[model samples]
Target chain A: MPLLKDNDFIDDTWQRLDDGAAIPATGDILVSLARLLADFGKLSNRDGRLGVEFPNEERPGVLESFLPDLSLIALTFPKFADGRAYSQARQLRQLGYDGELRAIGDVLPDQLSFMLETGFDAFEVTERFPEEAWEQAASSISLTYQSAAYQPRRLHVWRLRWARDEGV
Target chain B: MYRYDEFDHRFVSERVAQFRDQAARRLSGELTEDEFKPLRLMNGLYLQLHAYMLRVAIPYGTLSGKQMRKLADVADKYDRGYGHFTTRQNIQYNWIKLEETADLLQELSEVEMHAIQTSGNCIRNVTTDHWAGAAADELADPRPVAELLRQWSTLHPEFSFLPRKFKIAVTGAPNDRAAVKVHDIGLRMHQNDAGERGWEVIVGGGLGRTPLIGYTVREFLPETQLLSYLEAIMRVYNLHGRRDNKYKARIKILVHELGEENFRAEVEAEFARQKELDVEVESRELERISNYFAEPAFETLPRLSTGYEAARAGDPAFAQWVRSNIAAHRKDGYAIVNISLKPEGGIPGDATSEQMRTVADLAERFSVEEIRVSHHQNLVLPHVKLDDLHEVWKVLAANGLASANIGKAGDIIACPGLDYCTLATARSIPIAQTISRRFADLNRQHEIGPLRINISGCINACGHHHVAHIGILGLEKKGVEYYQITLGGSSATDASIGTILGPGFSGDKVPDAIETIVNTYLNLRQGGDDSFLDVVRRLGHQPFKEALYAPA
Candidate 1:
């Protein structure tokens, strides 16, 4: 798997710990919600990037009470048609989670722009796709219609129309 | 009509290019049929029973003469000579090739139209009253609001992959001509105590297998807060709407399960939060859109034209058309003329390229160069002068576009059933054609009075069977087409789902069953003003059901 951030593939240093898997005592690690809850004390004291993996069904409001200290939150796509993760990502942004948001599992190149708009800063992608494919997908539609929750620099047509008139 | 701005044009063209890329990928085997199916569907291409059917959105059912001509060209050049105008106020080409769809969309974009969100589990086209601006009974033109919705919901990021498709309808008038109560979100514009107009938003009403009349969520939503309120509804649905069962996944089911009170509370909470977001299109932007749909220029004339009166007295056929098809317009000397696509015994909304071209030409000449597609599967010339009606009628008569069955039994609304739709179990078009042919006599049609006979091939109710006065639903039993009857449904100001009459009938026997019901209503009527629907309301379903099943 490859980790893509800011339209570029960067070396992934984060380790994913599945349920019942022991968290490594040293480097940055991401753990599922169950694992995090089970070993909350031991993992928080390790001081690497504190990341929590969230299933799509879990409301982002769950983190508003606990995740102020968290460095990253990764949400799962699970399937292409299962878009609960997209809503989750937007809701996470709305809850003022300034931490890096990552989309993992079944996230396709086609959905990268949508993911980007909805506040996913990083993606765990299949290594088969080149970095260029991801970049092209991100820039596929140079402008969009609706303003998204996380995209601070909105490129909606209404804004673009005013910008055009100002430029002329 | 609302013209696409530079940004709108660019957005559509870019979308076209992107779809073209996806089509190429599908051809090259990079995308499987499973993967490509939804992508194609979002662009309004459906794989039906026979071939690919492409549905093109006529935003708010409004189109210019030029766009209608382009639609005619697409039907002539790419499709079989005719196109079906759908009950959503959109057009569908029955026979389309999967490969040609991208190019077809490109052609559509040139006319300020695209197929975006016509299908798929997203917010579909925002339909409005067909007699939007010109109707004498309207307070405001709903098309501009509908157009703003179209822009906002198009390729919407979060709501695109919803659990099930969402529909929104707007009616500017108090009469409910747009069938607002039957959509997922129905917006009715009305005045408040202070005399300021706003929307009375209705939620959760839909008729597929399960019929529901929407309940009001907001009594008076301010006009500027429309987008924020809609976003609140969509976000709530997108987040918590059930994905477990595809059948129970529409926002309606969620609204049903949560109870209307709880649902409205949840929606209000979301709306309170979303109101702070700057995601809504600016009011100035809405005003810019409103300017496009402002009243068109009209020639000064008396309320009644002597020329129209003379023409009506002179030609009985023209008189029949004028009486049934022409409705009072807001402007003096102008009438909103409904051009029935339902010619006697013809496919309910099928119009040939020649007929469409003639409509376009006639609209250019007499109708302020604008036309509207009706949810009743008819075309409307909204601004024709009373003096020019006879001339317009002549052109329409010559082109087979003059059907005087605007609200008559012959003007049946039928979904493309087993003939085209893969989801359909039996045929609806043939049933509609047969019933229409049976009541082809103009005098008999007038005598029986206003009756709406809607037929659906399957339970999906694309034919709006649940909301018809005489609803016929077709089911397949032992490889034979069976028709079930429902009575007394109305999609007007008083919206109610029809009741099931009795046992199912064969395809051949369904027309006679309808005839029997009409005759029963005629015999049971109290007076001349009593409509078929009104009579059914008075007498209930016993007489009609008994007559339908009686010894024949």
Candidate 2:
């Protein structure tokens, strides 16, 4: 699996740990929410950066206390059309978590732009689409109607209209 | 009509290009049918029973002459020389090819139109009163707000993938001509005690498998807080709305399950949080949008038009048409002319390219280049001068666009059921056609007075059968087509879901049953002016049920 971050596929550095897996001494690691809750004391005291793979069904408020110590939060899509993760991502960002937010499972190229807008910075990509397709889909719409979590490349049309009206 | 700004133009063009690529990818087998379905649906392309059907949004039911002409051109070039005007105040071309859709959308974009958000689980087109600006009873034009919502909801990042499709309707008048109470979110304009204008926001109202009238979430929402408040509601619905069952996915179900007070509390809490983020469009932007919908220039003229009066006195046919099709405009010498697409025994809302072109020409000549598509599936020239009524009527009569059945029984709303829709269990058009022919006499229709006979092919209720005065729902029971009747429903200011009368009737027997109901109404009513709806409300459905089921 390739990790899509900022329009480029990169090797994933974080080691995903199962519920009963042994904790490494110093490298970055990802664990499920259950594992994080079960081993909170041991995991928080480690030197490595912490990440949690959150389920779509769980509310983002449950992770509020742990967000400060967490470096990354990966939200599950479960299915492409199932959009619970989009809302979860926004809520997570609103809760002031600015870490790497990744989308995993059933991710497609066409949903990349939306994922970006709703605060997903990294995607666990499958071989369902070519690399070029992902890039094209991400940059498909240069403008959006509303302000969102990731708006670096895309500007809101209202702001554009105002700028044009002011001759900027 | 609202013209597209440079940003709007760019956005629509880029979207077309994107969809063009998507379609190419699908054609090349790079995308599966499942993957392409949502994408195409977002662009208003649906695979119907016959071919692809493309629904083009006429925003707030408003269009300019040039836009109408473009629709006619698309119908002639791409479709089978005709298009169906839908109950959502949109137009659907039935014979669209997948390969040609991009080009068609490009052409539409040239006229400041696109089909984005016409379908899919997104904020669908924002509908408003077709008679918004020209109505005598309206307080303000709702189109500016509708257009604002249109721009805000287009490709909205967080809300584009909701549990189900959302519909928002606005009405500026006290009469509720937009059917606001039957939409997912209904905004009714209100003037407070201090004479300050605002919106009465209603949520959770929808007509589908489970029809529910909306509850007033906010008694009065200020004009500036519209976007933030709507964002809050959408956020709540997006997060809390049911996802397990497709049938219970609408916001109405969430509202129903959580109760109105709980839903409102959640929305208000979300709204408070969302308002802190400052996402609402600036007031200046709203003012800028409102400038586009400013009242058309009108000359100071007398209230009475001698020419119109003389024409009416001299010509009975023209007088009859005027009596039925004309509505009082806010301006002294202006009249709103409703051009009925429902002619005698004709397919309701189906208009040919020639008819479309004729309407465009008439709008250019007499109505200040403006036309409206009503939710009842009719065309309206909203600003026609009273003095020019006769000339307009003459042109309309010549072009087969003049039908003296604006609000009569003949003006039926029928969805393309089994004839074109794959989801349909039985045919809706033929049943509507049969009923229309049964009551084809204009005099008898006028005598019955202002009856809405809405027919849907399936339980999805695309034809708005739940809100009709005499609602007919078609079903397939054991491989046989049967029509279920509901009485005393209305989509007006006093909105109520219709109650089912009794057992279903065969397709051939529906007309007779409807005739029996109408005759029963006439027999029970107080006088000529008492309408079929009035009779139904006064006497209830028992009489109608008995009359319908009585032994012949």
Candidate 3:
């Protein structure tokens, strides 16, 4: 139950709203995509900001029109071996959504750095690891073969040694 | 062999450190088995029937004498004193310990070898024709491009979590030594009519339950546009491949469901969209990779070596070995030798540490210190002088490796069945051993002529049974192991899946059934040089089928 963002555990302001619960007046709340789709009219009128949590099967294309109104999008990995969420995260980021991208559920320290490189800026981890663990996982290797999705790309170590995209 | 540069060395070392931490966490109970399984699998460690099996990658199946010796050292030091070569041109140690897996990987890294991506639901090792550079018939060396793809796909940020395991094979020759047609993605280097060289991309060929030959998606992908085109294919597969069922998750299944036209359209669209990504390998970088594959200095000698010819005439066994194992090299006075692991009544592809060191020493002295592991689970000294072959043959014979059964009925390709693999339903090695012993006579094997018998304990096709001349699939029926026979399958330029013969035989009856099929073919044969596959093709499996079920 730790929310790690950018190598640091930060205070989570968003509350996960369950079904049949009264909508809060002015706080950021995360809801399932099914919930948002079913009651978008009633939910959009609330005073609080909106965050959508995508179950593994929900297609991101359905959220095209709702992208502008969202502040946080959580890609859920029900289990560690289920990697449909990784592809889902990359697709969402590719559509020019600059909002906070977080990976929730079944997060392990070993996959933390890969999740980071694939454009997930935040992770809701079940087991808390030391700050040094995250630091080491995030920067274990300085070089990356593919360019990252996040802006100001920090994936390539060869760029530091040579010109950008230049062959050695 | 591509020597690891500083960047590659750092990447492997860092990966080892990372795995060491993960292993420690697993031991300390910080990570459960569920969480640790995929991590271990990605590093090529699998918990099998008895112990942890470590599969190490021999990139494109090319290794130096030094690397081969290091591998022999690992086999002697870590697990048992031997290793099993796999159909993917990899070597697996069957008795690895969980605690020493990371340390063993460190030892492998020191030899420019690591077990990265040998397993797991990711891109497996990139394999090419074992006779890649030395073959006279190939258009170009496939290893440089293969090495480039290996580096690009290693730890690829986006496509690592594919729905299922992916395999890609490349071949520079038109003969298809790498079984390119049965791979998920097959790249064939060909030159167009205008003399412009490029790749002919094939998609969706596989050999599991539903075997299908790959369809050509691109008639000619420019050599420079190779990576971008591959990116296009991977992107399409990642986005659209089936995720609901593990059996239907392979790219081959998606390609099958979409049909070739629709699949080609989608891949072309992705290729067009990513055209501006600038992901193609730079020419200089390609040159750097190609530099490592440059042809070694071969001695210029007469076309016919009197010494080699005299030795062959004097020794009948060595002459038979030469007839079966030696392939013509492009260079004069040089021949490519296939050191068969399938000796009479021995486990196919299993080599002892002493055999490995013998090969290493022979390669250093006679074959320019380069060795290649074939997808058939055979080893090749790609460039050996004709005069020195007698010496090489003597060394191999002393080590019991001069089987002289390459591409013959005795050259069986089999997987580690119930003995070592947890996924097997029956024992395949014993069956293979029995068949090998039955057909142990070299003259008889040569008489049979170019027959390929592949055996798998299950339908997973790890033994490539679906693509063999005589394919055997073992299954369990009511607590008894039953073997099904198939015929007419070929994994070549003309790739086709075999047809299952009616009914199944028990383990004891399987070898006799195969012999009956072979005898039937030999009786109905038209010519002495006609292969078993040729006869099977001319007359359908009905002949072999009727012969198998004949009374008595």
Against the true structure, whose TM-score is highest? Answer: 2
lDDT of candidate 2 over B387-455, digit per residue (tens) = 999999999999998999998999999999999999999999999999999998998988888899999
**DockQ of each model vs. true complex:** 0.62, 0.65, 0.43
lDDT of 1 by residue, B5-70 (tens): 788888889889889988888899987888788889999999887888899999989999999999
- After superposing all C-alphas onto the true structure, candidate 1 shows an RMSD in angstroms of 1.6
**Where's the lowest-lDDT run of ten residues in candidate 3 chain B?**
B275-284
Model 3: per-residue Cα lDDT over B233-253, one tens digit each: 987787688888988889999
What is residue B287's positional error in candidate 3, in angstroms? Answer: 2.9
**Chain A superposition TM-score per model:** 0.88, 0.95, 0.89
DockQ top scorer: 2
Q: Using lDDT as the measure, what is the rank order of every candidate, best first? A: 2, 1, 3
Q: What lDDT tens digits, residue by residue, belong to model 3 across residues A1-168?
A: 778987788889999998668778788999888788887777788888899997777667688888988889999877666677776776677666779889988887777766876778998986567877777877776676654445533445334324533544
- Every candidate's lDDT: 0.88, 0.91, 0.87
Where is model 3 more than 4 Å wrong at Cα? A15-50, A58-69, A148-168, B280-284
How close is each model in CA RMSD to the real structure? 1.6, 1.3, 2.5
